[model samples]
Target: MSDQPPRDSHVYDGPVGGWGSAKGIAAVARTARPGPGAFDTLRRQNKPGGMMCSSCAWAKPPNPHIVEFCENGAKATLWDLTSARCGPDFFASHSVSELSGWSEYDLELAGRLTHPLRYDAETDRYVAVDWDTAFAAIGQELQALDPKMVAFYASGKAGLEASFLYALYARAYGHVNLPDSSNMCHETTSVALKTVIGTPVGTCVFEDFDHCDMILHVGQNPGTNSPRMLHPLQQAANRGCCIVAINPLREKGLLEFANPQSPWQMTLGAPTEIADRYLQVRAGGDIAALTGIAKQVLALDRTQGGVLDHAFLDAHAHGLQDWMDWVDACDWAELEQVSGLTRDAMEAIGAIYARAKAVIGVYGMGLTQHVHGSDAVGALVNLLLLRGNIGRKGAGISPVRGHSNVQGQRTVGITEKPELVPNDALRDLFGIAPPMDEGWNTTAFVQALLDGKAQGFVGLGGNLARAVPDTDRVAAAWGRMPLTVHVATRLNRTHLMPGRSSWILPCLVRAEVDMQDGVNQQVTVEDSFSHIHGSIGKRSPASPHLMSETAIVARLAAATLPASAKMPWDHWARDYARIRALIEVVYPDDFHDFEARMNQPGGFYRGNPARNRDWQTDSGKAQFTRPAALDATGLGVGPGLYRLITLRSNDQFNTTVYGLSDRLRGIEGDRMLIMMSPDDMAAEGLVAERRIALTGAADDGIGRRVAGLRVIPYDLPRGCIAGYFPELNPLSPLSRCDLASDTPATKGIPVRLDLT
Candidate 1:
């Protein structure tokens, strides 16, 4: 049966949750067929002190209810723990060239990888290899090459135990060339948060959601990407908390939702309306809108008595006047032109902010995946700072993280940069001098591989070849590496793009029990809100031969590094408690008594210094950042071109394609379609459902283009078009990036739709 969606281009008009979400969850289960005990996987998954959702990084509340998982969480678990198995026979049946033709959705659906497979270039097929032989070969390659010649690609899916080991192994091997998933998605959030707030993470915890009087959601569709968030939002709405949604599309999740988990709501069909005010901002116009709002608020403070928190501004913030001056200097016409909103509309938004005593600003990739993404994030923070919204209950900046453990992984050392974590502490802990040299991020790592400067590459979890921008270039670059190793559960496009010698090391998924030396091990993972919780998978492994990510890291370390002898690699690998013990020593104040807290009722919250009002910024106070003018970043759709932003289909997560349909937007049975404004479509004489090509207008050295995409009329800005990524990834300019964070400007692609 085809798991592809229906061929109707009808949008889902039902409430966000309720029966629609139930059907989605049930459909995912039937498609995944993750064995008979799949029900158990759903029950144990994200069950408070159980294994957290292996999906998005939206943190679980401190005291989670019995049924804590959402539809997305259920889908993720089902996908990971699917019953389908890909073993030696499956590899023998399909050649690398032939398998490359299969869709990403089909490849992952073929099931969990059951063995370590080495690519046989002669036959263009992968053959099984023993763990020892594969480990030794990889070790020999590492031993032969200089550490600088290698790049370590890490992501957030791995548990904290495994990620810590991966970082420890990389440092022990004498280099810090670790590029990770954060570089692609939330890196700008980190850079901006650190620069102004003195913390490189979201200041608000799940607790803040309970107390916030109002919520301003910008550039995020939580209905699809983070369905679990609907729980808190629905609760907040029920409690009379006002919400404003700012985005190009009118997302149904933000409009109304009926919690699937709530029996009364589900049965009665009584849905809670979410967004009190919906503001449709133009693509990449978030900063412009933010500036206008700030300007209006300043005006309101002048006219209305005591609107701005003067005491908070004077005592806890710096550069207030300069920021206010910049806001005042912004021209109303320019702001209106850029934001695509009238002055009155902007003031109304400002009025909401001015009225609220405590407000929370939540944003996602929509705010951070642009050329001026860092500036946009800083501007959002400035709005919060103006009213002392941050570092207090019910108010703060929350950049909704994408990956499950991306933030936590960074907390435990999955970074490409240097000196972020103190080197002396690492050296003293492991008796190994950590490499101090700045390393490559995702963008630099790709370039280095293309330049043939890197000899080997190791991916901890993510599908790097498909996930990165410039798909063709990345795939070609993958073939140039001398050795490439992937620690993964499912087969993907990246696994097929092998070098001279490539190893696909099969690893256990999050929903499977990881047995270490006869002990069922539970690993820790950090959530978006900086809460660290234990994750213990209860289901059996897809394959008996599968190795835990922790074991893989340990074996790789033991084979490659002599310092592995000094470190308790064997003990730590056998029992994850040892890993926690080591982590506690490294981050004493945060992870104190780490092992003891694993089984607690609710996971420990690693307090954010910024949230506690302790500003450790360079200025010793919260810095009021002045966002640049609308045209400051030099961003544009080009002459006769449109701004193309990549979006995630309701069925997909990152690069993983759950299905071929996006029910939210009504497109079905296809992923290769672009949503355009009707006016833009008419201007270009392009009819709806007509197939066309999109050419990149970026001046980057490399040529970028994608062909055979259907255009559909949608409610969006005139100069903006929307397409799905990994498909549209080729159109993303490799050179055009957020300058401050080195993140690819994925959400701001300059493109021209071609009909001829």
Candidate 2:
């Protein structure tokens, strides 16, 4: 009878630390009598309120640290502490037209939606309404749109008092289409580093990686996406510096990273060897591998002529001879077939920038997911201004940004426009006159929701219909928005791309607790090394009917403004330190002492005067231009066309999904694949893992096909392919992007493929 007691002895009883030790010993050899919820699902896998330590949003904290998370912040803290809940009688039994036909992880695992919701579109569903009738039906649908038909997006995990009261309720609703998630990642390094070194971000810090000797990790990875930048690239690669990388996918956490917060290197399992020089390149061929490493650093300054700083290019700079005549008119075999890299790996990355005397580089969105992504970030700041590597200590140019207040939600004002001087000291500090002009970004709010001229769609925490690309043309231009709202903390696929009335609202959760009015607030983020800290939560609000994205942007700007609007939105929503004293009367030279430097504790210091060389540009120096050499066959190619690109995984970030798995190109559960280059998969006879499909040549050309995918074949190069972004954002076509930063070149999609 004891031998008969073997049905599934609590299947795979424990330990799964590194990629599930052979699937936890093959679930203990197919369960010997398992079922009792298999030891309560292996004692609830990531247990202790899963979502790994020091409050995640993919942790950083590090200053006098006590371990801050990472590993995609422990898979975004087990996908936001999922034990799920979408209460209020599951939206009174489903209806925003059948829960907008479910699936954004089944309306965020059906949980934590305790209250506020509205979309009763003829009772087609979504009702729980109560935060004052869902902030007066989003202030009666922003008082029936036409404030330039409304758009207000802003999601870099909304903080700093809900993006300064959602840019003071969109300049009290005049307009400024305020699209967010920095127009889908590093708005081409914030429009080419604020038009060449006036600064949009990254003048480097964290003790400038201890005075970098060489870094260059172009087209970034930071081990499974910013694993606390693997303990400063393992303390500058155990003090030997020179990293390099330039990815196309060799990324195994940049080839070996162990530092789980290094305690003498995590008890000697000590990994971090991070790329001393990898360089696979290819996808959108990072501007012909950054102009073939600036033509081998201008042929090593013509055979090492004092390694050229030429006195910081004759004091600061400007168009160095039309960037040396577009790198001596390109064509080194089409820069080795668009950067599969090789003139001895472009002279060993120009001999580590001519024996580095403090280098840095960095970069992400694989060089700004691009169609000349701002001329490949101005040719990596024209190879860091051909050696002056911007203003000093540990060279410059970083770009790795991915949320954590996406560059502090474009520094306090979730832009789209409204900074062309709305100032009258921010209209006597928010009394009125904020709307200045321009707006609608994210390619003009997806072309004003595809030219219906945007109706309404607020967001304030992204997933903008799966971080946009083409995705059924941005979910059919967000279903012709007649109101879409969202605010969120959970539930995504851009909250079911609905509209014609839809809400969701929930909020809170940057590792929880927010409170507001009665106090316990905190917020404020901005990191990809621009610093500005103070995050303050410590778990709690997965419920209690979550809210605090600064109390839903001050009760949706006091239920959509009009007591003839003029700020004082309930005294700056009951004080976020008077919304940093009106963001110090609108960015007083980088937020003067915004509430005494956010009451100290890693939060103040906007100072980035082009990291010292000053140049707030329009010339006080650091201005450099000349970029044309463009022509990637100006989108007209054949011989089985090509290009593609997309990317982002190591369990994704922009467009959430913490794990559908991608453990560095060994992919796993599946993100469809594609990759390419074994000579373009044996010149399309195709092989490695096969499958394929692609298509899209533009406009009803097989209406942007896609099909199976798979194909794999590693080290990409021959005319490119890649994949990943919102699953190959249907091979990217919204009339491509980056004609000087309109952005959407989600890393170059032109396509053709086949062999499915």
Q: Please tell me which predicted candidate would have the highest TM-score against the true structure.
A: 1
Per-prediction TM-score, please? 0.97, 0.35
TM-score, candidate number 2? 0.35
**lDDT (Cα atoms) of all candidates against the true structure:** 0.85, 0.66
lDDT of 1 by residue, 1-756 (tens): 001222332356778878877788788888888787767767766665467888998876666766778777888888887878999999998999999999899998898899999999988999998999999999988898888878888878898899988998888898888899999989998899999989999998888888998999999999889988998898899898989888877777888898776789889657898988887888888888988898889999999868899999999999999888888888999898888888888898899899998899999988888888889898899999989999999999998888898988999888877778767888777788887889888888888877788788999988988888888888878888888899998899998889888999999887778888887888888888888888888888988889999999999998898754469787789989889888888888888989888666456887899998899899999998876546323475456877888989888899998877677676787888898877777888887889999988877667777898988877777788899988999888778788789888888788877777
The sequence of per-residue lDDT tens digits that candidate 2 reaches over residues 69-127 is 44454445445545557777776776555665654435555545556676665766667
Q: What value of lDDT does candidate 2 attain over all alpha carbons? A: 0.66
Location of the lowest summed lDDT over 10 successive residues in candidate 1:
1-10
